[model samples]
Target: MTGSIVFDPLIPWPAIAALAVLALAGVVLALWRGLSGWALRGLAALVLLGALAGPAYQVEDRTPLTDIVVMLEDESASQALSDRPDQMTEAAEALAVEIGARANTELRRVTVPDGAGDAGTELMTALTAALAEEPRARIAGIIALSDGQVHDIERAPDLPAPMHLLLTGREDDWDRRLIVRNAPAFAIIGEPVTLTLRIEDSGAVPATGATAPLEISVDGGEAQSFDVPIGQDIDLPLTLPHGGRNVIQFTVPEAEGELTDRNNTALIQMNGVRDRLRVLLVSGEPHPGGRTWRNLLKSDSSVDLVHFTILRPPEKQDGVPVGELSLIAFPTRELFLEKIDDFDLIIFDRYKRRGILPAIYLDNVANYVDKGGAVLIAAGPDFASADSIYRSPLARILPAEPSARVIEDKYRPSVTDLGERHPVTSDLGDGETWGSWLRQIDVTAGAGSVLMSGVEDRPLLILDRVEEGRVALLASDHAWLWNRGYEGGGPQLELLRRLAHWMMKEPELEEEALWAEATGQTMRIIRRSLSEEIGPVTVMRPDGVTLEIELEEVSPGRFEALYDGPEIGLYRLAEGEHEAVIGLGPAAPREFEQTIATGEVLDPVLATMRGGVVRLEDGLPDLRDVREGRPAAGRGWIGLTPRDAYETRDVTQSPLLPAWLVLLLASVLIVGGWLREGRR
Candidate 1:
């Protein structure tokens, strides 16, 4: 209980001051005149003033509240590495015992786990939240048992007391990590993209060679090894093999005595995009379907089209001169012989041998197809004639041969059984109610798979692989009828687009492929194949664990399976000859980025509060009591400020002087002063 004197004035303070001033002046005048009752009169006046000035003794009853000490225990994944987990556990138990032994002290244990997803150690975030729950005045100190590699240091709260760190991990701990400094999210195919990387060693690194052996693999293929200098940035130039997502894995062989090999490997997933698609369109004559092919290629801004319509053949004996009829001469030599490789794809729209392009030029075109080139043939009535381009040297590479028969009948196109499994024609929509084609040339498919059929199951579309190139033949010119919305248009644009991209070697449209997509730790593994049944996919995890997962057919050709990966790193998938590599989460998780224990990150915050760091590996320091606003840590001990906080239970107040007692005393003093003056 505590008591203090307080006042409750009956009148205003100004009035009380005026009465006191009057009493003083009267006393002084009486004393100057030699009045005998001046002292008594002054006493009587002081008594009356004291009665009007209300004063009381106030007392309070309080209960002492315990001081709260927040102890943040780091339970992140990094703490589990090495012997840090045991260190953290031992330190926490010792601190709890010490806090409980202190008089009027309480311990608050806050366990901090790994952050959601890729978010690393959130030590400061947990500390801030723990402080917000308790009264600031009642907090004694804060202690964190961690590896001191905090990811959310910016979220540190203002400390009411001191914050000390009990660092885990030994002083001799060291690690080597692979860091990807600069990697583009999307790179153009066939263009050299430079990626910057660094190999860094932290802590007490052993004496080793300056160069480390680094291995790089693309799409789970064979890795190429190189000796790269450590502690320096490396600019690696690479050209993607195919379009779409490309997974590249980089790794360094684990060295002896390193903390872990998790940080020694990194995965980079970049998308391969085409800069531009160059197409050469050679039309035999101006026809209704010729514009369909031209418009389709012209609509895409990425496609660069070189279109030539063979108007006024050399055999036509017109009266007008060739110069008067044509604006410019066709440079067949420049297109077919000189820069044939510059174009990615060449289309023959009803093109025939009209003595325009010589047999040598046609032979060069066939040679172009043999060297990783794509050719699409859209045939019409002229394809069956003796003047057909198939009669030339190009016949060696074409997928189909003309049967010299053109069936003029209404028939809807249908996907063949093999086409149902091919990515190009699979999932095109329901083929039963498609629009009818007016005519289809009879052809014998000899080298390629028939993707579509019409007019009594005759081969209408064929695709083949010729050495390093691809060839596709569409045996009708009536595809424009679908574009014109005949009996409700079919997937004309989609069909042509897929067909063109497939020939150009789009990775997503490959018939035999394997890949994976990640959503958090769950991976959706996909396998595309032409065969009806395929073997189970072999998945090799980052930790060298192998799992064989059987994929179920989700669609006609697409097989998929979901696997929840327990770790984050590069995953290799293989099914027969098809192989793919994908990254589930971060290649190097944030926890493993800096595995060495250090207090540099928490130095600023600790200095502001007069706190220090103590390494648990050196021995847990003793806890001591310290005063507020003084140094809270020393060499052998850490200190906690004693917060003498209390809660008020009750309050009482009593007047110092009663009104009746004051009045009686004033009357006695007045009468005594009158008698003394009368006597004088």
Candidate 2:
């Protein structure tokens, strides 16, 4: 309880001022004239004015509230890195007991955990939330237990009391982490991309000197080790071996006394895209479709297409001598054998065997296909001729044999049941109003799967995989006419693109493949196939648990399912046909949430005013009054600095007196006194 005196004015200040002025004038007149009666009247007037200004004694009952001490405990990933978790747990329990025993003081314990992946710690955020529920005036101090690595320092609340930090880790604790300063999301397959990477030393580093040997690998191949400078980003020029997604793993040798190896390695996945895909186009004769094929391949900024057209047959040469017939000599051996490996893909548009290209060169082309090379054959009616390219040494590699019979009729092309499920030709269309292809060559039974068919359901396109290579045969040369909008056209560009990319062993088009994309702790698992149906998919989690999920058809040939992971780790997804593994969480949980842990991170203003320092180690300090701007405790002691504060429940106010009332009263008094003097 508390008490105080207060004022309750009956008149305004202006009226009181006027009364005082008149009373003073009366006294002055008495003194000037030496009149004792005037002095006596002035004294009485002063007492009358005093009664008009009212005053009263006021008091209120009050009780002091107990001080609230916030004990912020960080159980985040960083705190768990070393023995900090155990230290924090022990320290928090002891502090809570000490604060509870203190007179007029209470303890509020706040526990903070790691946020999502690599977001760091959210200690201050938790503290701010705790502050809003408690009385600000009763706050004594805030003490935080953490690893001093907080992520959300900007959200630190204005604390109402002194804040102190108890850092968790030992003085000798150290860590080695892989730091990637600048990593590109995409790189050219053969061109080197520079990666800025370094080994960072923090806390206590082992006595292995400043330099460390780090191993680097791409696409899970043989790893190469290189000596890297510590604490500085070193430029690493890496050339990708193949196209599509490439995973680059960087690892450092674990120091003998290092705390954990989680930070010793890092994985970076980048897509390997060719700067320009080199392609060789061999055209046998001139046709409207020939120009179409050239334009389609040339339009892609990423494709380098070299096209050659044979305008004159060997027998139709001019009367000039053989040497003078044409200055351009065909370099069959050089293009088909010597430099064949340089090109990523080779396309033959309506091309047939001619006297210019000997059977030996054709054999070289066949060997190229068998040795991981890509070949696309766009057959025309000439494929059925006796001099067809299929009749030469290339016949062994051809997916289909040509029959001399030709069918002339209008037929809409459609994907076969198997073709509809093949990634290359699937999802083309339902053949309602699609653009029409005018011509298609007759092909006999082929070893590969038939992707598309024409009238009477004859094979129109066939795709095959031979040895380590891939091959595709498009039976229609007139397909290009559709690109010219002969009828209602479709996505000709997209169709041809998928076809070309599929033949190049692009991972996305693999017949049987498993892959996944992650969103938070959930993963979307996808299985692509050329088969009509896929068996159940089995997923292996990092915890050695295997789960089977049924895939639903999302597209003509694509199947997918979703998996929510219970923990952060690597997960393997596999269908009956293919298998793939993906890591969802961080290799090691560093600081989760906003990682920085400061007493102010909880309530900034309150912490500053309370003279508290956020310590992640010592936990909550015993509430004690310490001097400002000095060590919180002497030597190894941990203490809280006092905050000077006062609280008042009652407040009183006064008002000015009315001037008219004061003047009227003074006039009456002066007139009455003069009347008495006249009567006497």
Candidate 1 wrongly placed segments (more than 4 Å): 6-54, 322-339, 358-371, 391-403, 407-422, 426-437, 444-459, 482-490, 530-535, 658-680
Taking the tens digit of each residue's C-alpha lDDT, what string does model 2 give over 453-542?
986888888888888788888887878756877677766766778888888788777766778887777888888776667888888775
RMSD of each candidate relative to the true structure: 3.4, 4.4
278-317: candidate 1 lDDT, tens digit per residue: 9999999999899999999999999999998998788888
TM-score of 1: 0.88
Global lDDT of each model? Answer: 0.92, 0.74
Candidate number of the best TM-score:
1
What's the CA error at residue 327 for candidate 1, in Å?
Answer: 5.5
For model 2, what is the C-alpha lDDT against the true structure?
0.74
